[model samples]
Target chain A: MTNSQRTPYDGIVMAAPVTIPYVRYSIESAQWWIGRALGALVAQAGIKASDIDGLCVSSFTMGTDSGIGLTQHFGLCVRWLDTIPLGGASAIAGLRKAARAVQARDADIVACVAGDTNHVDSFRLTLENFSRFNQDAVYPYGAGGANASFALIARNYMRTFGVSREDVGRIAVAQRANALRNPHALMKTPLTLEQYLAARPISDPIHLFDCVMPCAGAEAFLVMREETAASLGLPAARLLSTIERHNAFADDPMQVRGGWAMDVGELYAMAAVNPDDLDIVQTYDDYPVITMMQFEDLGFCRKGEGAEFVRAHDLTIDGDFPHNTSGGQLSVGQAGAAGAYLGLVEGLRQVLGAAGPTQVRNARLGLASGFGMINYDRGLASGAAIFAGPSR
Target chain B: MLQRCEACGAFAYPAREACPSCLSPDLAFADAPRGGVLLAETTARVPSDVYFRERVPWRIGLVKMDCGPTIVAHLHTDCVEGAPVRMSLQLDKSGQAVTFARPEGETPNMADDRQWREMTADPKFRRVLVTNGRSVIGQEAVVALKAAGAKTVFVGVAEPWRPFAGEDLLRRQEGVEVVTLDAADEKSAADLAADIGGKVEILVNTTEYVRAGGLLDRKGTSIARDEIDQAYLGFINLAQAFGPAMRMRGADGINNSVAWVNILSVYALANWPAFGAYSASQAACLSLSHCLRAELRPGGIKVMNLFTGPVDTEWFQTVPPPKVAPRAVAQAIVSGLKNGLEEMYVGDVAEEIRQRLAANPKALERELDR
Candidate 1:
């Protein structure tokens, strides 16, 4: 099989990034959160409610509701409607599908929305019956949810690559520092490297700060052709390139690299950019170890050099790297599928110079990557999309 | 047992319908090579569910097998990354198959390992309650429990004022106390439970009333009635009395109440004409144990059923050789308790019946009478 030339995103652009203010726990259902987010997206775009002709919804707590269900609930009638079930990769994956929809003229504008409501016990309930493979094989062992599995992955990756707990602690500490600047981040207090190392382990190798807090919220954005955005005079971020993969590197005994490693070369090739050209990067960071893996796999550093890369550079917004500049999910609470969208939305804000306090200086180019859905041992979905400032 | 794909020759776990590798529909479920290396492990200090949360510091790991498919398994404390581990499929309290990893090399205090403790009901320093002491099987159970390091073994002697043959020796044995109780009488069971219910870590019910006769040979329901009282009704009395207390203490320290044992006959699977009344009673108790398991599972208590062949006792004088001895039953009970096995078939006849029943239930039922 030969690789075919990829289609360019061309005139497609993303605009009107909306975050529906996360809360620790919400008495309201996922419907309320999604409705609020969709409402906010329309208001921010300064468009009529019916302007969003196509819809793509992503959520975990909406029960039986998907994109189709939301259409009736929100009175949406559109040509193209779908849902992304990729969990932490939901928004990035939704971006790929919606971008193609708009490029192919399926709809004039597509609203990509991800939301989830976190009740006190909903997180545990979701984990208890996460999936068939998980419930049958993983949950029965210790029922530690994702924490236990990632601990193993983290421990193995550290040993395999000669990384240390201190190196892993650096990721969490820096993210917490970045979180302090973002007023909406769940973790408000300043964090130090010492506190990260001293934090009691949730699962060994994964400390308290390494894990994301579960919260209720929604994130949304609009995908449209440049002509459509120009007519409305909306400030939008141009889509440079994107890549998506599932269950990649199936033969590796341990998940040292994700699908990003396999397709990262093409990602940069399609974007017509080098790794050094990016001004900002946002990696799906449910855990600090995963962030390290992403940094190495996404071409920020060599495979075994992620530890040294973190040590050599600071990761806070004002620092040299400025990765996860909007605090990521490590500081901002994980809002189910919205956790996947956090990076994409934050990346859009940075590229468009729309980020307030957490904005990167003179941000022109950025990348948002996602990894999610641990059906059994490791996460299956991997995706990334480069966002640039409307091609200058 | 793991499934092997015939087309791709790759191994798949968790009983899949089609091959994960080749998408081959041709698959065989058989015992695969148990060799595997521990990839990573975590002793989840914070568990997700109440069942595991109560038993905190629960260790689990990722194990990629010599065959294929990485599995999440209950890991022994000694299971370290890059070290070899042997895997086994054990039935949990819910009667579902779960993988467990054991160290290839012997580890110190192996029985004390959390993984072993989770899977077994080892009678080490835990209090035990035996519901009957009149039969040879009952007497030997007391002796075995004491040898297995039971802190206290309470022997329930019905109508203790009327002494049994081994009454003097049982009372004289260290850590063994004879208590007054009658399985047939509800008050007797309740009284005994009220005294020692909170402390009984393991309960062994060995009350069996047997007589030689088919349903047609029996004139009245007199003999059948006695068998039902001792086997079926008596079991109900003990379970009702002691179940709640054991459940409440299921997650208490090492001395926590663990398992309830039932001595059953393999003939319960298929009735034996010669001992029709006895077989019927055994079947009834076996059915009830399944219900008791579900009820006790929420509290993490286990209801283990021990199936045995015809025992060599006065009641089986007319039967032929190849009978299970009382001592053998006692030994099986102790070992099964240590293993925390839900079902144990003792003696050649019991094992034979179990296999035959699995292969062909209807055929075994027809052959049992012959």
Candidate 2:
């Protein structure tokens, strides 16, 4: 899918929490769980399997055939389909793929799904599947999984971006605080920077709390027309515009040239909106460093200023621009599919004024971004969504 | 000899590896009792987590030693304290040492009372429901709701699952009917709270979980998701199924009294995973309990999440547990309802988690791993 003449979709729907039994299987089973959950969600929306004209799914645990399997499992017959294989950024990629389908009029409705409970064998899965492509760069380090990979990313992010140990501590600490309010969240205990710093370090600048638990859970969503959404008693949050960029082969730091700043002028022009127009923002927070860097890339603040932005509590609900109001993956315990779908849920909730305790008052416009495909040093995919509230 | 650190006031186990708390190298061993009253404890349905799944259906708990330091340990089936109990820390063939117990005398009379025998003997008792609100209460309320006659009884819990402690509650309250919430998931927790109108008669909220540490000592890695899954599933699933029955019974002469039992701890407000997920999940369940109290009130169902610090149960082994007992904690929870108290404090630490929740949250980061 090329980025040209992308039109904003009227509304978006996220169908999730579709359960897939995966405790007994390998990580690949997580992909099947994702397919099952997404299939169930699309069926529940009363949209015929054949009516799903577009396909977008984000799965961290699946393979190339994973997306195709989603179509076959659900028996959705679509000619214009996309297969997005990014991990944490998979959902955002799917959303972008859906938006492109809508813009091209190739498909009227796009379905997005992500769910996995294949984390128990996550270490082995990474060695087998994740290392297949980056074996040269990753195998030499005996890198275990995303944790080991991100450990390196974190180490570099801290050195290059000037992020303090305290800053990393503060991120984990804040996530726990936010999670305390969410019942579905896995981790609800409180944490302090002092205890966080004192925790056994996995890699440099990364503590146990600094990484997300390899959890087993399921969640999925649907993207549809504004009218379709209203008919179902489901609230509608308008997607004004979207932009997708990839630097898959880059060796140098893409912090400055990543998706957030890669000529968003066209995206802004297409959406007819600016950075200051957003009220709530959901930047993919796989790691604290990615969160900070993406915050800058999306133009929330200047480059190299990501640390300053997060340090000021600017991303919390009480701040000027709240991010990840649903306690995020960091707080919600990182149920791969559910964690990614959270941005959409939070965006919809903020738009609908149903975010409850974490709602940003009078929120109208919001931005949700995702970063994924971490090889060793950085992310390969980043996608952003611009949503306008119901009041607008 | 087990002596409290004169400096930090913390009781040191096996003397000091530089006080786990203040980290002062200076420490002295003092005389500590070999046994004490049992504190809060739980019996496991299955062994869980990668490290310990092999040892299924074991009992793990906080036992307050006869001395001062509270510790966690694995207990044998015959282990009951306040009755005679011998403690031995043994290095197993696995090379890891854990404390064990051997009952030294007749079981405490409190453990073999009429109520305990009655509740434990009932075949239907396996599906006990602990309502965190006015879903069901004592004998009068239970009978009142039963007169209207619903097939199932939903017992609401104000906190997460502590099966062994919950059994203690049942033993104390004969024909004590209640419904547990089926809220391990998002929609079910909400549905269980919402579906309580006419079917449920008496709503009693036993809404507090036990905790021993503040923020610092709370260990995140130690507590796994499988444990949380088992605990929540065991508790909430019963609550969800019990709701429909209560709705069917609908408004007999059931008394609706909400109880928020408070236990004591200082960082109940601060972020502390070391104290365990039970605290935070209890807080989440407490929030749901509070919301249900308000939402289901019109439907004639009352909700209240209790906040209690710690209790003395057989759960407490020589490893150290809370100072209070099961009977005492049960009495406090039951009395809170009978006396029209909305929130009850069973211990000091229970109140601390509540106070922490009531106050502004501290600046803790959301990131756990990098």
The numbered model that scores best in DockQ is 1
lDDT of 1 by residue, A314-369 (tens): 89898899899878898999999999999999999988888999988899999999
lDDT of 1 by residue, B154-182 (tens): 98898878867988889899999899879
Model 1 scores a TM of 0.96
Regions of model 2 farther than 4 Å from truth: A1-28, A39-53, A60-65, A75-80, A230-233, A248-257, A337-339, A354-357, B1-370
- Look at candidate 2 and tell me the lDDT of residue A233: 57
CA lDDT, candidate 2, residue B247: 36
The DockQ-derived docking category for candidate 1 is: medium
lDDT of 2 at B369: 11
**TM agreement with the true structure for every prediction:** 0.96, 0.47
Return the top candidate by TM-score: 1
